[model samples]
Target: MTELARLKFYATQAHPCSYLPTEQATTLFLDPSQPMDAQVYAELSEVGFRRSGDHLYRPHCQKCSACVPARLPVADFKPNRQQRRILSRNADLQVRAVRPAFSEEYYDLYARYIEQRHADGDMYPPNREQFSTFLVRDLPFSRFYEFRLGGRLLAVAVTDVLPNGLSAVYTFYDPDEEHRSLGRFAILWQIAETARLGLHAVYLGYWIKNCRKMNYKTQYRPIELFVNQHWAILT
Candidate 1:
């Protein structure tokens, strides 16, 4: 048997659940002082850990197990009709992978997305500080994928490159382009990028069954869910 590294973990105080309003949520995070390199992060991700800014954490709620870590096995992935249409619809957009840096245009799109689409969510009233803390951070393997059409920015996907695959940290797009389904296209692009890189999977943070906002994650077939200390294919 392989021995894992000894690491310290801390749990946050109970807070209102972000997905399910009726429940409380707690998070288990690795020690901040410890080194968090790409190798360590990849190991942690295989066991269902997720990164927010510089913190690596996972839900540790005592009363509920609604948040399930999800990942897509790239080799087995197959897009449905709707996802295919979304890809074709956004085919004209150009994608570029660049270093994660603060940009006014990206921030503007993010602010508008939060203001118009997610006013009731926690990230509403988005500001520069909050945006920087959430998406822009000092990570060697992180990248910002920019989507554009005719020189106009449409979406930005913040992704982290792990040893085994890519991790979808967050995505924000022009709310006015809702008809283009930019969010779905962003994920599809990530999937294609993962395959292009010959990676194994794409880690999609957490999927809550009861949350309407997260239901779309299940639409990607051949997805595996981390449950009861194991990853099982969800049919």
Candidate 2:
């Protein structure tokens, strides 16, 4: 076993669950002092760990197992009619993958996204500090995929490239572009990019069964869920 295999983890005290408000949630986090990299991250991801900012963690709730780690096996994925339409709808948008950095244009869109779409959520009342801490981190594998139309920035998909595949960290878009379904489009774009790069899968964080916000994840057919210490297809 490697050093990562012997890594220590600490669990958080029970707190209000973000997905299910009625329940409490505890998170098991990798030791922050441990040096982490793409290789170690990929190893942890295979066992259902996820990254939030610079922290690698997974839900460790005692009473609920609603947050299931999910990933798309790129080779076996087939987009449905609606997903295909989303791709066609946003076909004109140009995508560019750049290093993760603080950008005025990106931050403006992020603020608007949080204000308009997630006003009631924890990220509401967004500010520069919160924005930077959440998305802009110093990680070698991190990338900010900018979606532009006629040179105007419209959306950004914050992704991390792991050894095995890409991890979809977070996505934000112009509030006015709701009709375009840019959020869904971002995931579809990642799937295509992952396939083009010969990756095995696209890790799409946790999928909570009872969370309406997470229901969208299920639309992507043939998603594998990490259950009982194994990756199993959710039927």
TM-score of each: 0.97, 0.97
Instruction: Give me the runs in candidate 2 sitting further than 4 Å from their true place.
Output: 1-3
In candidate 2 the C-alpha lDDT for residue 219 amounts to 91
Clashes per model (N, Cα, C within 3 A): 0, 0
lDDT of 2: 0.92
- Which run of 10 residues does model 1 get worst, by summed lDDT? 1-10
TM-score of 2: 0.97
Tell me the tens digit of each residue's lDDT in model 2 across 18-109: 77889999999999988767888899998889988889999999999999999999999888999989999999999999999998998999
- Candidate 2 worst ten-residue window by lDDT: 1-10
